[model samples]
Target chain A: MNWKEFFKNLKTEEQGCVPDETRREFLKIGLIITGVAAGGSLLNVVSVVAEGLATSEELSKEYPYKPHYSMVFRVDRCIDCERCVEACRQTNNVPEYGWRTKILERVDTKAVDQQRQFMPILCNHCNNPPCVRACPTQATYKDKQTGIVKMASYKCIGCKSCMSACPYDARYFNEEKRAIDKCDFCWESRLSKGMKNTACAEACPAGVRIFGDLSDPNSEVYKIVHQMGKAVWVLKPETGAKPNVFYTIG
Target chain B: MKRIIILASTLILGLSGFVLSEITEEGVKYQESEEAGGLEIIYTKPVKGVLFSHKLHVKELGLPCESCHTAIFEMEAFKSQRNPDFIMDSLYKGKYCGACHNGQTAFASNTKCATCHVGVKGLERLKKKAQVLEKK
Candidate 1:
């Protein structure tokens, strides 16, 4: 038989196989009338179905990273001292015009308690980074091991596509390096040298930046993110970059 | 003719007053010396490097020289470091910068370690800047 006739025959067989009212009446009278009698057997069927669904669900629920290197900003603690910026510049050999990290001053005279606040910003090191996708030569790509978005300086063509694609305004063109430069969580300068934290996080006198492995349960980053009764959020979450950098009040 | 000249001079004086008021309204004040601005003091006692800006305190915060100069800190630079108690503990005890930086008046001396503590790197930067200024 052709495909249409085969589907018609399959539908007829399915309808004929199912006993209509007798099965419905048995479920209603026998199952509904006896609470404890039918309840245990129904629960077993429900649990079996749930287990089957959970096994299939595990494929999509798996986390992408092993270490999952991430950073968090305790935003309210920042004082706009620019010490983190200076430390980053000195450690990374960043030129005067460019900065890998920066502190943005927000002043509102009408604000209660505090009229001025500072926001420290840097590369978010997103799980789905737009810069990695935008780079034509694969100059900017996420590290497979640590998941840090890093630069392969030689492959960079200075096209500036990654600069435009970045939602956080993180990337800057370096004249001396002749490539796009951004915060690589100090992997090149410090992490490779066995240092535990980024220069910016270490330089923060206010305890503003908390950098740690997100995958580690004992890490400060994981604790802050997983903690209850705390409002932790990421910047521009609607962009779907899945940024690893988190922000909170304290 | 005398009445007309008086009217003309009064008009000129009124216009000058308007112009002078506009200048003052912009918050432009004449400084007696260039040293009154951009003055940085580095502390290297218990810590490697710490920075204090005179412009922020004197100009922005509107604090007078007497607020810190001879009271909380001595007039001489790096003199506080000579004392054995010139550390964060001292600051917490309301000594040195702790008098104002007690978290009530300003940020607590105990908090924001990197804000003032520029570390050894900041000290090197200051030295480089001084060298460049000396060359100029």
Candidate 2:
């Protein structure tokens, strides 16, 4: 009743205005429309929608996180210059022993056409974050708002459980911080300051990393992930973490 | 006496092999030869970790030195990288590696960048190999 109106009024420009379509759709379902969730998302509102009205496609394709911070890589364009790595280090003050992001090189001499491919990887910020689940202290978690896998460093007990829990090997124990450190999609260093893109995305000369709001259909990340022309894949899909990071080729 | 002479000859042959082309632990061939096995050049400018294999171009493709040497590139290695014009944009406009890699003659430089890039990881790998070779 008044709660919906109150929230609607409270909706600042930054949090994004909820489209009338979504509001109407949620209204039709007779659900409170707190938030729309994507595949494997933590929101309870989606379960209600899935129970009656929404199709599987809508369930899977919908953006669960507001601003749905995500990254897509044009891997074919990546030269693995490590410029992104250096930028991330400088921006985040990442130690030499610890890495928030890195490039993995794959060379298959027997492969047809180009035998070398470089894959840049960071925290996937999985909707169903095992690292978050494994953290007894809740030191690492998936933010309900931005869906970024963030670290509450002070809360950490120097546990390495999240390190083993992460399927992408994205987490590392930081001796300096005495905490588990991973990519927060540059939230602390950039996005939190109203910056549009991550440090790595900005540093790439090859346009390999495209970071943006995946929830917004207009965003390049949403279009690339939804597009049919090129293959878009996430690392370790079988792990079923529902990673926000996606990979594509030129 | 015969064994000593044979060993000496083998050492000479090994030394001669270094004069033209040398192979790394990864089997990537590097050379600065007039006939074949051209030098493998790694570019740190524009960006880091771009590898150009002379074996891939001159030896594997069997292209003559005249195709690139003294025309598209100087006989010197990394000399082209010093030129401010030596970049992917210039290649796209039909300069340097772009001369033959323009999709008409060879694969476009824009496509499959990792094929040449080898990246910073590749550069470090090469450096480590150099250090190991020195130890040997």
Candidate 3:
């Protein structure tokens, strides 16, 4: 409570209780236990690339959703064609002022040859979504079966808390809906009708966007994320949202 | 008669036009003199922001105009764009830019996509640059 009472109850450091060698031995044992828990999967053991960046989960702990939906962007292949953005607009009926997905440009003058790159971004549908946590009403929620962050327009109070909470800049307020709206991986448009992929993923002529169930071993998303061949990463990983969308070069 | 002929020639030269490519950030001119080197080309069909720098191919790589012109590309800029067949599929099949970009003569069209595909941002940047130059 108060400073005086807090100081009275505070415990001082108990030094010389354990020797340095003993503490190091305990640490080594802890590492071994963690290694055993990870099942010696090289990517999991090394925690290189996607395993380390996308989530805190060990290999065994991943794919929590029943048919975990995920997306991977082969970023090098993207030319900012904006076809994916257009497809998303028509398919979802997103307002002209709003967007479900966007392409970002990074321009570097010092780089040799090509000095510009385009990056397309959308809802990461994070396993530990801050937006879901910030929603006072049950308006925004992460789906159980597919792990998509969805919005219930009727329940929204237009408080705009979830908009600020999102790390990916994914959510947008729709005036017509009178609520917040976000990318649902086309769950409402096509996936519910047994379509195989999102409108964006299907519309990309460059094969830049790969969308599939992360839990299924046969899926492309699972293969790309699991392999050590190419480095895969998520945006603002330090925020610890555990995003489903990963990015990598072709 | 000579005075009248001179005035007509000057009018033709002015009407022909030339692009004023300023010194890029790398401190290299993307085009040479107003009369010699070709202009910078940006494609906006099928996709946007695909760039073709003549200075890179001609000046840096030392390719003569005949290497692409008359045989591969016509001297006219944006003329190939009129063809409906001018797409990536055609390039992969050893047509147009693919004639040189087929991995043997140069890097393949599929590889290093951003090298030429400057993107929508690049298109906007070029437009902005032109506006800024006009204001100056």
Candidate 4:
């Protein structure tokens, strides 16, 4: 079927939230152009063409990273062991007062089965990272190669803007490193040396933390996120950060 | 005079209750058997408020004391954590709790973390219960 026909069907299917006349007309035209360029397939054309058109229209825009490094916390599995925290400290030489990663305990006496759960959190490495924008010196920037949010320690002036701007409370001032420090998925200490996973993920006795390339379909992170009916969600999604870090119960 | 004496006694009782609540014994001395039931181990090193329950392991699972004592863990409650190598890395390498919890013999240590890791909050809850029981 043609892109117009497919969109018309989709519009009908989504009767609950109908778009305005102008938006419908715009979508119809956009789809037609996308269909012609992509050699339209009736089966997967809608999603494929939609994404292709959006990205292609913005010539300056590009995929965040080839590997798109991400992490997922199976929150239900975290035991509050703090092994990941310990490993991150040892691996990165994180000082005693500050932490690059941490486990937040949630307790609800009213809940059935397990009332207590530990949530392991770190730098989300957001696609639209607020920390990157907040940095006056551009000290903290998202790495173009792997999409990992990295710190250029030398550039940091201890402004703490990135620290305050971060919704996840991930960044901290390090007297030792002489800059704002946060989890870079162990990029400098481990990935730079060709290690596959972060120290936290490696140290977790329970498979609580799954770190891998979100861009690679074969990676476990992709499978867990892309699975149908799985409730995968990111932290502070309302902030428009589009975090690479995801969380799920199962 | 009688009303003042009554008020003084009541004040003394309230003060004594407060003092008793504040008093807590430092360091749990390891013992083979006690009236309070099995041991409740709390590890302070590396991190705070990690708990291991002997009651669940022994009573619920029907595992004998020899299953862990003197082998995987020493007789002392917090002795294992005293060693610098007594971390989760050792567990992943099939040491300490990993020998049984390696996903084969038992639920893998990497799975169901809350099952054992009752964090600082859990540890405090257990300690409070112990104190109440001790008072009784």
Clashes within 3 Å, all models in order: 4, 1, 0, 3
Model 2: runs farther than 4 Å from truth? A1-62, B1-36, B132-136
- The DockQ score of candidate 2 comes to 0.71
Docking quality level of the chain pair in candidate 2: medium
- Worst 10 contiguous positions by lDDT, candidate 1 chain A: A42-51
Query: Ten residues in a row with the worst lDDT in model 4 chain B?
Result: B22-31
Q: Assess the local accuracy of residue A60 in candidate 1 as a C-alpha lDDT between 0 and 100.
A: 20
- Provide the global lDDT of candidate 4 against the true structure: 0.69
lDDT of 1 by residue, A127-224 (tens): 87878998999999999988899999999999998887787778899999899999999999999999999999998766889999876777887777
Looking at model 1, the pairs that clash are A205-B112, A205-B113, A205-B114, A206-B112
Error of 4 at A182 (Å): 0.9
As a TM-score, model 4 comes out at 0.61
- i-RMSD per candidate, Å: 7.2, 0.8, 1.3, 2.7
In candidate 2, position B117 carries an lDDT of 84
lDDT leaderboard ranking: 3, 2, 4, 1
TM-score of each candidate structure, all chains considered together: 0.58, 0.77, 0.76, 0.61
Residues A98-153, model 2: lDDT tens digits: 99998877787798988887788888888877788888998888888888999999
Is candidate 1 or 3 superior in lDDT?
Answer: 3
Ranking by DockQ: 2, 3, 4, 1
> Could you give the CAPRI-style class of model 4?
acceptable
Best candidate according to lDDT: 3
